[model samples]
Target: MAPPTRACKYGLDCIRNNPAHFAKFTHPAKLVATRAAASSLSTSKKLKNQKPILTSTPNTDAPPSLSASDDNRDFDAEVVAATHPTTASIVALVSTAVAPDVLANISGVTPIRVLADGDKIAISSYTIKRTHDHYYCTCPAWSINNRPVDARTCKHLKLVFGDAYEAARLLWKDPFGNAPPAPAIANKPKRKKQEDKASEDEDEENDANTKKASSTKAKKSKKNSDSSSSASSSEDDDEGTAATKYSAKNRAKREETKLKMPALLLAQKFEPTKTDPTGWWISEKLDGVRAFWDHERQEFVSRLGNLFTAPDWFKEAMPKNISLDGELFGGRGKFSETVSVVKTNNSPHWRKIEYQIFDSPSMASQPFEDRIAKLNALYPSKAASFLSSQSSLPSSSSSTATKNSHIKIVVHEKCKNLQHVLALLKTVESKGGEGLMLREPQSHYIGKRSNTLLKVKSFYDAEAIVIGHEKGKGKNSTVTGSLKCQMASGKEFKIGTGLSDALRIKPPKIGAIVTYRFQELTNDGVPRFPSFVCERIDANKPSDAVVCILKKD
Candidate 1:
């Protein structure tokens, strides 16, 4: 059989306007048109005679227009009138006939319950019934203008048109034989002004918060100034002589003197045991920068005496009128960087550093607990209204007034035993740290240890009192000599490693105690694998020191 033509599949309209193409076909054009018309007429007659089939299977190929509840009867009428102007009435008739069944199927309801006589339908739950002349559904979609539901051209109307409406359109052909143009729709209004108004409101709220914060800061600064003035007035008579000695000229000269504060004394050995040693109070060593706050100066000074100017918020949290010895840290693992930043004057990086105050060094004569009580009282949990207040102006003009205010101070807890101390130290080191510091709970914060403070670090080393020197070997042989020293334990050890060129030229003098990094002890109680670190000018030999010698038994 010959291939079916496009006209045969689409219908007579496909070739209605193309006379040139129709002329080439063997069959006469009029005969083809007659056949198509006869077929369509027969199909229409058969559809009219047959009853509607209610099948379980759904029609998946059909595109969903509007929802089943929508009643756009008028829209459907307008669409049909626009698309098939001549056959609009027939189209409407077909639409009304098929819509009820299609709408029922789409809505998952049975048409038998919804359909009534004389082109009427009842939406039972809403108590609304519809007819061609006066249709209505209680559904909100059909109430846009309170028109008859059938005139709304909702989803119900679209479903009613179905294949019958399309079939009718296929039967009729326009002389132009072209598809109809789409209807125009009105544009919606914009909401730019409302959006702009909302944005402006948000900006106003932010501005209010900023103003409140500034005002609070200002009040705090004013309060601190009043307190500092009162404190100075009370001490004026008693401190007259001392104040004269530290007058403007003298103070300026003293500031020029670069007095290096003592470095932390690190422990040489660690004994991991269950029991605590006698007279030793264990405490956790915080991983932070070594800091010394000079209360007399009314400034937070680092170990290097570089003043750390903090924000009013932070300053308002620090303890007033007491020097504190502690660490300024930004968590762990940032020690070297923190130290470098603190050493510099006016560096903004110090803002990230927190001062973990462990001792009130200026109150050395007072009991440890007493000092802590004073520090705690200075920085209360709930700040005073003055301290909590904000400033309306910038920080530069606000500095003098905010002086001598409290800052945040973290105190290290004293552990119960050596094991707890060791555990804390191990935790810090395991997470990449330096070591732990132990402070006696009952002891005062003395300038010197006074046997009250001890540092605990990994890697054992001894601070040996230098007795003499031995000639250096290999590359350092021609320079100075090797260090022959006696430990506080009185044991003798030769530090062969860690000798620099300068150290070799001028070895530590006799009677000078120097630090030696070493490993385990030998059989004869002598230090094994000793290496030179640095000389300890501030250390002294114990009275019961003995000579330790390593001998092969």
Candidate 2:
């Protein structure tokens, strides 16, 4: 018998080693492609004994690695070139194992997929393509770095493929064996039922952690309460004549009135362009408590649906037919005081606040300009009846009563141009104002964040779902280390720095919606310098949340 050709020998060897490799050779074209691949692999083997030559230099300009440089280095291609088989060999071997259907999934010359978001609410899934030995993602992170040609990877690639990413990098010597453990910071996948035992172990760990946290919290709370009560008692004793009586009355009037979560129209963060300001209305980004006026209930509700027990007179003074969305402002730099006043049932501190109505929730169906017009009409500047008229009181008291108790329509000016907007921003910030809010002229209110409304602040803010809480250490031992949060893109991260001490002590529950502040987003859509801002009390449960501000085309 004649000796077998190189291609024939290679095919025979592949079949012998793994018969399943050729089991799907039923397709004639596939068979031909496989044979050609095998032949190429056979020819490449001749150079296997020779020293490898690396043609592509490392792309030093690539973005910084998300993890340790050593672990996430772009050495995969170099490693394959030196230690493993050639590209032809690897592709041939890997192709046989890949289901033919996967090829059909490929779009155009490169296989790209823009994954659809869960709620179809966020910016559509970004496009990602597998080309040669590298991957390209159509995300800010990838584009911002000028699209490096090297085999650099992004979080999107790791997110979609998971363990298979190792195989793509030639890091997995045996694809059939267990995949290397993914980093803890990586998106840890949900375990399969086969790992029920392991899941149970994890549950036990969580329970132990929870018990420890609870015990620590209890101890801290007891200590804090003792100190607070002691100080409160001393003050009460000193002011027993009227302060004690007033304090008791305040406590008695503190009724827990459950309110409906307000329908909030959130703002998308964006930079102003010359044309962008043309068709928008601009207003100051008030740093105050978001309050929703429930017309029918004759009450003021917090974003989380908790009732703000404004004095009976205050609620009665509000319009009866319309629901208004605005901020409760004492003034600039009064955020803490605003929060303190609204969070309680009946804080006399409310006397020092004003409800600055901006948008009418009932007018959400109307154009934004029309809504503003109607809101302004409801509280006209000349309407002295609604304005605080306690001029008979002392200068300080009279002025505060008139300014604080009265409701005022927030003024919004038509944005003339980008230069105008910039000049206005400068004027506002120069005077200690926060920033500017831009509302698309014709936009109707939506119960979610939309590009129609943009917050052009110095910093950016977005929302994510709380996935877990990391335990704190030392000074924060009884509280939390960081809030592990997940975006709609399935990206996970920890936010600790911006958290308030109170929030850290009792972090938002897992699956709660939390707002975060960041300087910008990475190429992978992960927030850079992400820190906890506040819990989105009005947000729907995590499972049904539609609160994410993904970059749009």
Candidate 3:
């Protein structure tokens, strides 16, 4: 079907009102009904025998040549002649309405419903309307463009239909192969205005292209473009075509190839009955940023896939072929400092940070013990035994250089039984270590959290959803007092302690899930002395209730 023009209403309404004269334009169902009604009104033979007469016939009753006095026609006669549309005139109007240029625009555009976010607690959505071949959108962009009733379209229309508005208009063709010849334009000013608008659109497009090219050049120079800069920048630009909340520079930086997340196994909460630490390899759960080294890319990435820009010199000692999964640690309780060092593009602070290798996601199919053994062989520790055992192999660097490598292999000690596990946990706790990680000796590494690994800690901790914020008082009057949180069981509590001054000024959002540590449960089952740990971005609102578990000392 051809797109309806601005004058479509007059032509279509004329055909609808006088259907017998223009039944071919009506729908098949409506046509069938009209034919049946026509047959019932009179026999078919009577209609065939009758001569076909045009609805619009020139008036012959008046004088063939009108004088000046005759040309002053009666007002009522002029009105009646203008109001009624003749059959021949209506056919001509329909032919013009479904012109090749107009029909082409109709086929390309498509309306779609979209949900647009409104206020803080509200949502607004509307449908794009296409009625009688005219398109309109309920979006603000359409309204701001003055709700054009003609062929003019807004950004929303282009986005919803497609970004082929200019092409569609230029490439329009007659669908029925019977398009009428385009009408001649005698109005020069109107034609000139259209030409000027086309010129302006072309100028705008050229300006936009120039701006984008300049921006690309500036961004390339700003970052000291590497060999990969051109390829990465172009890819970033292509991806940036989609709307994003972050800035262009930030979005480009974010798109840079970071370390693929290591699908290494994660630990579940320790359950005494279902879990037995007998013969299991145990190691202290280092409190640091979880880092994965991409041997291929020579870059470290966080669990969430953010690039950890370590100094070139720092990563130089790492093995080129083998990817390592570990913690980028600055000793115990230095997580924030380590994060700051690793997060920076280039910093001397990374020298103090160490990559403690534990597992490899690439060799995740191997059992826990075998995977650890392979990791040890690829990047041997500083121990003399490692040096003597693999001394025959050609070294990438000098033995002295290997000995001075900053990376450490976490020693996984096997526990005799549950008693030994407890004893090791106590010793580590006394030394202010974070916690213990117990791995199932025979279990193969998997990507998800499972019972094959478990975390045992001294203090009880649980995740809660942040519900609201309590304003601070006195010295802390300008900042937040505490975070009001709710447990899965619907219990609400206020966590005021252990929140840093920075966090107090801008606390976690209301629906954020955060971890909190506490000593023990109260008689009423509330966590006693609950302190803010950190936001659990990896976790959702936990299914179980947040109640403290009492561990035997």
Candidate 4:
């Protein structure tokens, strides 16, 4: 005969109809887990509640590497009931994380999951954190169950990673093999535990991390005592302050270590007579999202220092040792499509995209020619045959791109003269290209805008944040007519000229960074005849490029 049916780790929430699941675990009707439900649990299991501390955010330069050093934290949804008194209190909720959408938008990077054989999964319905090894769930059964934290499992986790995955993680001998994830810069995941088990982890997990930040109340007590000039009293008197700080967005009180901004080269406009083009490197200016590849951390960071979550295979195709500065391009006239794919977290649409490299930030000290040569040398042998000939360029230069068959070298040719520059511009623009970029020979890459790199465009373009929206007039009266936008310099304007019907009906989210084109800036430094182009980098914060009154889009 088979062993007694065990209580499902999810209790009643275990909605799996899989005969496989039903054969192993039984759903308990009551909140109190029955013998069959928690048969595997140790009755004498102890709650490993440790003092919670503030966790920092990951470096802006790269995503946290997938290691196994105890990174999984459950910053679940708003709790349903008050503290059980018997168990740890749900004293706080996770604050909104920075660019969390980037995580969610990526197809399968998050912890929220579904039962593949059970039912369709709605990832947004739950708040879960599934790290490389650790897993956390908000379900009361898992949180308050009489089991070791390392041994804890839930139906939610089973769904996200699948049954085989969840099983292997629980069985791993070194659960915390992943490196310490900087907690949350924006939100602090509260520590909770089973009725008789450790609050965060089984034994080693919560105790190790908590000992580092042991007394949250004591920390708050000292802070309040220092700040209280009007009223001073016992450590117990600051309960309200502790509760307030630990309850919400103000919770993460770790050292304020800001994300290090990446230094990258910017471009200036080409002046026909003023700037010389003879012997300069000329290439087509791709209309795609600008990204900096941080090889050390293995992630794609955007121009203003935000993440663009590319799929694993997409990143795998890139060079591993050197850092790169390039554009995530789809094709000419496909700027909006490219942004849509890159901005979404771990999107498969990435297959349609390519990392068209222009320069290498790692080789910033080297001349532009040398950087191009370095990129060409690292090019994979799988490069397409139908690419530009390297006969005119250094023998190191390759023709096309593809490792997983993505990532390409932006073809660069030396400018012979002024006519060569204009003719190239005409060719690119005629074929629906953005324009041409001219790089000065032997110029070392600089982070700041300079004459070393120049863009040739028919019309000027800049990015602005969407502040509000206004309804249309006349025939388009029902839909949105304009997007009220603001620049980094605090100047505001409306973009209504180039909006399509789809965009008009559903305008970009307020505060979205949108690209717009114009003839020139007004005397007051406003765009003239501005037309909407597409959405750009969006972190829901003030635009750093707002100061770029004429910065090319």
For all predictions, the C-alpha RMSD in Å is 36.1, 25.6, 29.4, 19.5
**lDDT sort, best first:** 4, 3, 2, 1
TM-score of each: 0.33, 0.38, 0.40, 0.41
Worst 10 residues of 3 by lDDT: 190-199
Q: List model 3 lDDT by residue over 1-553, tens digit each.
A: 2211233223311212222222223223222222222221222133454433334454333112212342211111222223322323322322343223232223433111111211011112534544222344444323322111223344444443343442242223212222222322222101100100100111111000010011122111124456466445533332222212234665456346333445655678787788778888887776566777888888876554545556678787877877778777776544434544554434445577777777887787888889888777766544332112222111112223553456777767777888887877765554445567888888887877778888887776788999999999888898999999987777678899889999998899999999988744433345656789998889878433344232212
List model 4 lDDT by residue over 1-553, tens digit each.
2422566667534444343354455444332221111210111122233332223322122111222331231110111111011111211111122113222212222222222111222333554543222345554334543233334555455555444445554444224333222222212222322132222211111011111112233222233234343133322233222222232232242222222446878888899889889999888877667778988779887654545556778887766888898777777655545544554433346677777787998888899888887787777443332123322111122335435446667768888999988887765655556678899999998987778989887776678889999999888899999999998789888998899999999999996988888744544467756889888865444342332232221
Query: What lDDT does candidate 4 reach at residue 133?
Result: 23
Tens digits of per-residue lDDT for model 2 on 151-241? 2233455543332332344222122334433332212221111100000111011000000101000001112346556554433232121
lDDT (C-alpha, whole model) for all candidates: 0.41, 0.49, 0.50, 0.53
Point out the higher-scoring one by TM-score: 2 or 3: 3
Stronger candidate by lDDT (2 vs 4): 4
Model 4 residue 333 CA deviation in Å: 0.7
Residue 520 lDDT (model 1)? 39
Q: Whose TM-score is greatest here?
A: 4
